[model samples]
Target: MRRGAKRLLLGLAAALLLSATAAAGYGWMVYRQAERAAARMYEPLAPAEPPLAYAAIPQPTRVIEAGGGLGTAGSGQSESAGRAAEPVSGPFAFASEARAQPSPEEGDPFTVLMMGVDERAHDRGRSDTMIVLGVNPARGSMLMFNIPRDTRTELVGRGTLDKINHAYAFGGVEMAVRTVERFVGERIDYYVKVNMEGFAELIDLLGGVRVDNPFAFDFEGYHYAAGEIELTGEAALMYARMRWDDPRGDLGRNARQRELLQRLLQRLVSLETLGRTGELLDAAGDHVRTNLTFASMRGLALDYGARLRDVQTTELAGRGRTIDGIWYYEVTREERDRVRRLLADQLR
Candidate 1:
């Protein structure tokens, strides 16, 4: 080979090596940053308390049994059937200590309870939005539904029937989780709690998101048209918070919240947003708390994400009633059973 040609080839090789080194270093930095952010966001529940005794608590007058056992006809009654027999006790039952944690790498189906808490200075605040997601990678589908903030149910730790959202205000995440598990009749594999106040900043960090608005409405000085619309951080926050004008009230607002979340998730996993990893991690570190570790999160992104193409959303059906001058959304036992079946089926 000519001397000049040899020099040119060496130069190209050196440049390629330098580029590879730089790429590897950047990838490591991102991974380290994610680990740190996950550490910051990690907030596990305190030691699990023994399952609460439901027989001691007062039962509602109406008793309704679900059609059949939550098991196959030929098979004997399932574990879920035993849990369902004692309506009050079964739902509130603590997650079994022996239950194995589902693995994303193995593509095991799992459930996540997402809570959006409206916290303020010196106040713990309530979980204004509670959404349960059942993800089945094998089925390439996800089932999502919102539990109305005002749905009247027995507050697990408090031992009183009240608005479901009050569980957070009364006992924070642990209590909130237990209450929700009772309400849904399924064990939640994980939870992600986001401070609603800081959620705006996180949305803004992602350069905002686009969502389909069901109808035109003006909220908090922002006018949302009846079609697809782009929202800034503040606009999205208000959009999710407005419930008074919504004909369905909290139910309607819940639907909008679901829409916002679905859109946000879609944006978060997009290539465009991946470029802003540092900013997103910082924002999430401050605003979000979850039991999910960095490794599990990476697995979910790499393994289960592409398979979860279908997203189905539904709301808990209930009616509003006033008790002692206070209004509450009341859900029936049968309806709760139906939700349980839906989630169970999704996991299976």
Candidate 2:
């Protein structure tokens, strides 16, 4: 009623509004800062080889070895160790069968299928590179064992035995995932497949990866001197793709793949990657795919990095052989059993 009284009331209201506005702005700032902190603390997770990228469908025929005896599965173990021993449940049972969610919320291993495809830009190709990785953050260890793309195995969702890589070619990621699951007798939780183009960008992003020159001679204007050398993106691609020049053939190529991976790992771990977070996420979003939620990767990178401060490298034991005019890597039963146990324990 009084003009002076009305003016006083308006002043009080303005003070309250300003206080609330200040509080809200402060809260928003805190949230953004926290997200950035988490992002900065992370290292790129072990790259998911694209083998698991296409698990959305089922294969027509899948490899199932009856009584070949996969693992020495013991009782009273974790689900990962358990999944390592069971048979693939096929596409119909995917979500229910493959528990892609991380239960521990922290320090649980992020399992991914790593696929290296033999195709170039303007060409779509299936993965010729196949490897199963079981990374246990709890154990602070990363383990990868390759599956010979030509391993003689039955393909699930299909009619008969075919080269393992054929599963991806015929059915894409879904068939590829199913085929790998049957071979190792383990449930693949996720995948990140990168081809020649993506590989080149990634190598360049990291400013290049340093690899051990296990072979000599030149290819495509590059000479890989024996021992250790730093490789740029194009050079790294040529370097990683060279197998014919090596004494071991595909075996040498396989070794080179592992080396390329190791160089990435070493580079990722050695740097302060906070500034590159945007570029990193862009690379993963464009070149990588999986059942993994962004939250899941963020959790694993921070949680696992905290627990496992170290990583070790390994390869599968197999002989290169030709079957029906196709080259295949034949892994003996003993090798399967050993890798199974090793991976299971780390994953646990």
Candidate 3:
């Protein structure tokens, strides 16, 4: 063979190899992007999370001896305050008590209560905020709506409504879950409750999130415009709570809140955060609490590889009404019905 022909052949071989490598790299990038998106969509229970009646809760519900079950009793009370022996149903305040009789539907789709509590050193303050999320894979939609804390009605355990958030503080986790179930007339398959402390940390971990301000406003010395900007966790938290600056008040905060959640999911599933899975999980485990076990979370997380679509958020309407000289957000019958129907459609 001629020397020129040999050189030409070698050049052709190199070009072909480079083309193959480039194609593979592009494909890998696409796969990774999709994988992250799916992970974000999976609001799964943790491996430690048990069904409503199964797992143990965090607090020592009642004091007892070694080898004694929850119902067992000694000098049932905490050592310090001598707080009357808590009913022997919870430690972590598992949803067990709420599941004395389980929901009619066993999460064929899935139901979750996204709760944010105000926690101080010595006291687990009330569930200051509550957002219920009902997701249906079949319908490919999600429903989220809020229940104001002060709205009085029938409480779950005591069957009297004082403040919705008080349920958790009064009876712990199980009580809060049950109270929500009774209020919505829906069974809660799982819950994720976290304190606001780690909110800022998670945002910084995900490289911050982007949000749009409908109108420009000054908040806590930070000015937000009606455009996109990267937000730190503290900024985002502050943004979500800035109802005073927003003309629309809580409704505006609610919109921003949902926007924050959606973007967080998107960023969570992006390639930028792939190598940081352990860190993300650690942040979540420390900040967020849920009954979903490791096994359940894995299974749910695996399901993320399937589809990427915009999540659906329900728009809830209610009037702030005062009863007995106190104020509460009261959902009208029509609005309540609409939420139920929307939830059912998504769950189906």
Q: What is the C-alpha RMSD of each candidate to the true structure, in Å?
A: 14.8, 18.0, 17.8
Give the residue spans of candidate 1 off by over 4 A.
1-26, 47-99
lDDT tens digits by residue: candidate 3, 98-211: 444223122236777777776768897677667777755444455666666555544555845356778888876777877776556566777766655555665576677787
lDDT of model number 1:
0.64
TM-score of each: 0.79, 0.67, 0.67
The sequence of per-residue lDDT tens digits that candidate 1 reaches over residues 72-157 is 21122222222222235543543333446687556778888787666678999777667788878778788988887777777887
Q: Give the Å shift of residue 247 in candidate 2.
A: 2.0
Candidate 2, residue 120: how far the Cα is off, in Å: 8.1
Q: Assess the local accuracy of residue 2 in candidate 2 as a C-alpha lDDT between 0 and 100.
A: 14
For residues 96-151, what per-residue lDDT tens digits would candidate 2 score against the true structure?
A: 13334554346666566766554545555666767677777666777766675667
Runs of candidate 2 with Cα error greater than 4 angstroms are 1-101, 118-124, 306-309
Model 3 lDDT, residue 37, Cα: 31
| lDDT at 131, model 2 | 67
Preferred candidate (lDDT higher): 1 or 2: 1
All candidates in order of lDDT, best leading: 1, 3, 2
